[model samples]
Target chain A: MVQINAPMVGKVLSVDVKPGDQVKKNDVVLTLEAMKMQIKVYAPADGKVVEVNANAGDVVNTDTVLVTLE
Target chain B: MDQLWEIFGGIGIVHLTPGHVVMWLIAFILFYLAIKKGVEPLLLLPIGFGVFAANFPLTGLTEEGGLFYIFYHYGIETELIPPLIFLGLGAMTDFGPVIANPKTLLLGAAAQLGVYAAFFGALLMGYNVAQAACIGIIGGADGPTSIFLSANLAPEMLGAVSVAAYSYMALVPIIIPPIAKLLTTKQERAMVMTQMRMVSKTEKIIFPVLASVIIILLVPKSAPLIAMFMLGNLFMESGAVERLTNVSRNELMNIVTILLGLGVGSTMTAETFLTWKTIGVFVMGVVAFAFATASGVLIAKLMNLFTKNKVNPLIGAAGVSAVPMAARVVHNMGAEANPQNYLLMHAMGPNVAGVIGTAVAAGAFISAIL
Candidate 1:
């Protein structure tokens, strides 16, 4: 399993996928808000999402695991 | 007949001096640069004409009751036009890039080294402390800030300093690339930054207010420039104020630009602009700009040493307050180094920060000297 990390510290504005969903590289998995800007976090590779860690409205920090892809 | 000769002697044709002819030639060169070479035509065209009009002996265009006299007195001397120009600039600016990557603000601060370099150079050239401060601000590569500083500290050198600042700003494309290239390597130039995180609307709405409140509290002297700039930004970000935003960026900006140019140009009488000291200001102005660009790049490189993520050093060159022009140069240079590399969005972080940095530097100079 490959763990996808949050890029910056921010509140999760939205989550785009769930466990078992497939994502291609660069496809946005979630949106985060920090410093008054929304940041789109993208999938790092073509994979099936095996686990989802964070949900919408959750506060996250840099490198916090957001998803596990297999 | 002797009485007739004396009476006619007061006519403009009889009063024409060598200085008037020399100033006319200089004005023609400004016209050629603006119209043909296409260097900052919006301001340069009106300024060139103002110079010509002011030089035509006894036209009173620059005197108390003259046409341009109003522009000089109300627009420049009273410090009305520059802050208005800042309003337009703010409405046109997008702070998304700077807000997304806040660390780039340091690159903006780094570029102020140019202002200090020129300040000392001007002092060494025998300009007084006030005059040197005005001359040093030319390195900021921002017209309004340079004008604001000169109006307060060295009104006599306003014409020379304004011309130097605008001319160097227009030459940002030519001046920055060589220095940027010399300081960076191919691999460094090819370094692509990560994709920027998107900024939210709520964040956008908050930025202008927060910036004004914080920056003003830090430097009250910058209130005029910063306050107007934030007001314009607020007009744009509010979404409810489209009409005001459109007018500030368009009609108001155009009119103020014309008056500002004319007012600045009219100050260039032969008595003020033709002196040896004017030449020294020009020399120091270029020195300041070059140093500012170099310092930005060097600071970026220095930052790279400590940070895990490598930044393309060219963006640092955009720290000189020429806005997108300097940023575009960095983008083009990055493309030259690597075809797929696009640094425009990233370079903007430092580009806009340079504007704030220049304003802050101007405030420091104002508080210290004035």
Candidate 2:
């Protein structure tokens, strides 16, 4: 299992990955925004995106999961 | 013998009086304003219901062992509720607009003048320092913040302070316009603004972290409020933290609001609420808010004299923490002046800035007094 971690404290401005996107390590899978700034969430080890945990405009705390990778 | 017989019959006995009825009517009016007029109903509903419940004859709703008593003892007495509310508030706020255009903080700063002004006004009206402080907080126009201050400073005037606070908040839509119009000329209101730079995703992410440090370090008392707001904004901006944001903005905010609303309303009772002092507080509150709004617009116009790029003075109205309401008002008013003007997005810069400013001003007041 691959874990998606919050790169920063922010709201999920947009989710780039759906339930079934194949991703490589360090691929941008989600976008997070804080203070009007946006950031992309990167994938960990190479994996297929199994489930996305957040939709766009959801607030995320530190170290929260953004997706499930298998 | 006749009085005793009538009292014993339980027929001539009325526990609630005309004054209590007036309070209940006021509470219902609040409900109507919230439901029909869209004034902070999330809070007005619980507060209104609590008022009605407490005002009902012989209910003991706020007495010992009552649920409201329990809530008051647990939170309001210790000043826990306001700070906790600030936490959820922090989690829900978007500080980017304020950060992108840091100058709007001054509008928020200007609005706080009402608070201090009310302080002096109340003192002259014969209230001691503590009572005057409670009365002054009505200018802040935040229910919890006002309740928190009154709970700390003057427990005697809780009902009056709470009513005045919420009442003025409801009146914001009506109260701000005349002041807004008076402060800015037709030319100032019709002025166009340079489009704000589309803040990058990276800048948005850094805002909360950077601001928490800058603001909290400057005003430690504001840590709870400013920190919480920035944290909420962080959650909203963080791509990875969806669940937390949803919880903070929705479930968490909703639940706390219910408790806060009712708990605050319980403070109002016939004995505590019906007084000439309450009237004084309400009047002073309106004057304070009007002064605050006028100060903001006038200051913006003052700034307009120097800037190469013109700014719509209407954005100054966003300095109040009523959130999107004041911001929306700025947008509408700007459109009224010029149909082609698109000020909503531009006004948001000061709109969100006002949130932070009000919290800071509250922090400053809490710091100075307590």
Candidate 3:
């Protein structure tokens, strides 16, 4: 299992995947808005998304786990 | 009957002229753009009101001892408000990007080519060098710098130049994209840059002091804006002056913004704003933005020739000092080309550097021309 943390403090613009959704390495799983720019969060490795800890409009920090992959 | 006529004669309606009516229309346009279109409402709303009030003849709003006259005289003419605005800006800015990638500083400096381009453009159009310099700084896309430089070199052109600067800044989204598209190929725009190294708190804290010493030492005339700017940044980065940082970026900033807006707007009287020279300023303003945008992209591509880690040339458009607006524009363009590309942090380096670059350019102009 692996937890995908936010890269910085930002608002979750969207979560592109949900529980059980498969993602390829470097595939965008979520988008975060910070400093008035949209930043995509990509998967570090091929995995199945096990959980989404955030939603659109949710403000997040660097330690906040945005997704759990297995 | 004569007494009644005398009373009526004293009212603004009796003193209104076609020029005053035209100015009212211009003010309404500013209001619509601010309230309706949501374009730079912070400055434009107050400036629009200032235009509306100042045009009301016999009100004395812009006359000596009047309200706006006081705002203009003590706030802008005295060179107080713009520097205060810089204080707030510095407090709010995060220099982590620039510190992580110092080479982006050159992109910021290269963007100043637009300033010089517009300077010569203004001169060729027959403005005196002082007025030309004021017009040239409009390309810097910094409202306060434009106001500061114009207030010193060409107080007469203050209204037109500031309005031009801020208006163009708000239009960064519209202006940058087409020019950025025109300058770079799709492949270059799609280049993905690696994540920048993390900057330390110690580096952030020392940056303002070191930058202040170097910039002020090089351009002594830039001391006013640069001094207050670095001081405000110190208040933020010290981690011990949250109160001062909060006030500098918030309360004090709000107070000064109102004064700055009204002060700039009060200068937009019918006599000063409605002229052929004012038209020239608007024309040269767009030229400056285009040139600045093009030069930044070109320089980035030029730098790519010698560097090992290639830069996405589209980030160069972010060097126009429109803050996150230009950076966001670059990010969007990058995303459109390659979804995995995150150019915001990368673009921010040049974006913030552009602010410093523009200030230094203003300082240089003051040193050479003043």
Arranged by TM-score with the best first, the candidates are 3, 1, 2
**Residue-by-residue lDDT tens digits, candidate 1, B1-370:** 9999888967998889899889999999999999999999998888888888899887888889788898999889899998999999999888888888887889988999889998998889889999999888888899999999899888998999999999999999889989998999999998878867878878888999999998899988988999999899989988899999999999999999989988998999888889999999899999999999999999999999999877889999999998878887887798677644657778888998899889988988899887
Interface CA RMSD of each prediction in angstroms: 7.9, 14.6, 2.8
Q: Would you give the TM-score of chain B in model 3?
A: 0.98
- TM-scores, in order shown? 0.84, 0.77, 0.94
Best by TM-score: 3
Q: In order, what lDDT does every prediction score?
A: 0.88, 0.73, 0.92
TM-score result, candidate 3: 0.94
Instruction: Please identify model 3 stretches exceeding 4 Å from their true place.
Output: A1-14, A24-28, A42-47, A50-70, B1-7
| Better candidate by DockQ, 2 or 3 | 3
Compose the digit string of candidate 3's lDDT tens values, residues B106-164.
Answer: 99988999999999999999999999999999998999999999999999999999989
Q: Tell me how far the alpha carbon of residue B223 in candidate 1 is from the true structure, in angstroms, after superposition.
A: 0.8
- Please give the distance, in angstroms, between residue A51's alpha carbon in candidate 1 and its true position after superposition: 30
Residue B87 lDDT in candidate 1:
98
**lDDT, candidate 3, at A46:** 89
Better of 2 and 3 by lDDT: 3
Residue B257, model 1, lDDT: 92
Model 2 chain B: weakest 10-residue lDDT segment is B7-16
